[model samples]
Target: MMKGLVSFFFLLAGCHQAAGAVNTKTILLFPEATSTNYVSLKPTEKVLHQITVCLRSYTDLTREHSLFSLATPNKDNAFLIYFSPPNNISISINNEDIFIKVDPDVYYWKKTCVTWDSTNGLLQLWINNKRYPRRVTKTRSPIGPQMSVVLGQEQDSYGGGFDINQSFLGEMCDVNMWDSVLPETSVRVILTDQFSLTGNIYNWNDENFQVHGPILVLKDQYI
Candidate 1:
């Protein structure tokens, strides 16, 4: 009886450790060449517009592509992060779009963070720990609660309507999203490849997402 009890306790401890290990594992996505390759997240109760994506693009900056998007059935409530042709990183919140020039050298394996608060209409972007000038937008209302979050493709409509020209053709990993804006220090920690803590809404390791098209799941090589 004593031996059986001891073994049962050990088994429970082992299961706990295994679960923890799985929760911290990161995944990499290799998108398709012609079709859209993406991971569709399960819809949560409320939309969390604050998001971060750590990815690398091997495609040339001359081509346009989308990295991620949180879309709604209504086009007016979507949020997107995409690369404009020739060398620009652009983001669209609701219906307003903002963009900035990107240096060619920093396109490899970078961490980009974006935050928006609908109440104050404050929007900010951070790349690899460097912060950009804050901009205000959409002060009148908050982002709608219904969101269809997808990676590697921009949603022109609700869940479908992917344009091949704006499809991502690289690797993505360590994606996260929070309902509220994270502190500057936490964003810096993610940039350093240490995901000790993460967002509450969509955490890459903890959440399950459906992969569409021909996307390949490779071992994360960057971090």
Candidate 2:
């Protein structure tokens, strides 16, 4: 019995150490909006990670009725991206979140990118590779601190009541994360997807972020 106990303690220590080594990396997901790719990530430290994406050309069906979001099955935290056809962009968080939408009429091509920085608590809007000055919304919760990341489709009803049948149809590429929020200027540069060392980046096109499996989540109330 004594020998067995000693072995058990050693095994437990090893398990703890391994779990501690789970560093937060960029989670890149390109689910068909109908499929969900899930991952559980608890940051070793609090940092701002940039979710890079290149939305595919908008379609009438999806543009009129669809949303892109990051959420967990717990329903405690959520960030929503919704834009109907014509001209309207809005973002709302049930809890700690940030996102942007482009007004098709305002911008002819409707090409733009936005950055959500958890560390600095800022939302950046970029148009035609130019950084536009805009007010940032502070998170009610500090980016959930630690969250189980879910991408592509909604996780049951936890995703702000998003229906799995309504998924985003687009390509998300060159996702990255840094231990700190990026400066406004840096966000403009990286929007081109040619920058090096944005800390950690998951290039969906590169296959670093894959689709398969159920994501993990903490029971904590995030937002």
Which tens-of-lDDT digit does each residue in 1-223 have in candidate 2? 9999999999888766644432222223233444444432232234224333222222334343333454544444444445555655454444543444444533222334555654454665564565555536665343433344434444445433445454544433233344444565666555443332333433322333334544322222111
Model 1: which residue pairs collide?
none
Q: What are the models' TM-scores?
A: 0.78, 0.52
Measured by TM-score, how close is model 2 to the native structure? 0.52
Q: Any residue pairs clashing in model 2, and if so which?
A: none
Clashes of 2: 0
TM-score, predicted candidate 1 vs. hidden true structure: 0.78
Indicate the residue-level lDDT of 53 in model 2. 29
104-204: candidate 1 lDDT, tens digit per residue = 53446666788877767777787777787888875445556777887877788887778777777766766777778877787776666443455577766
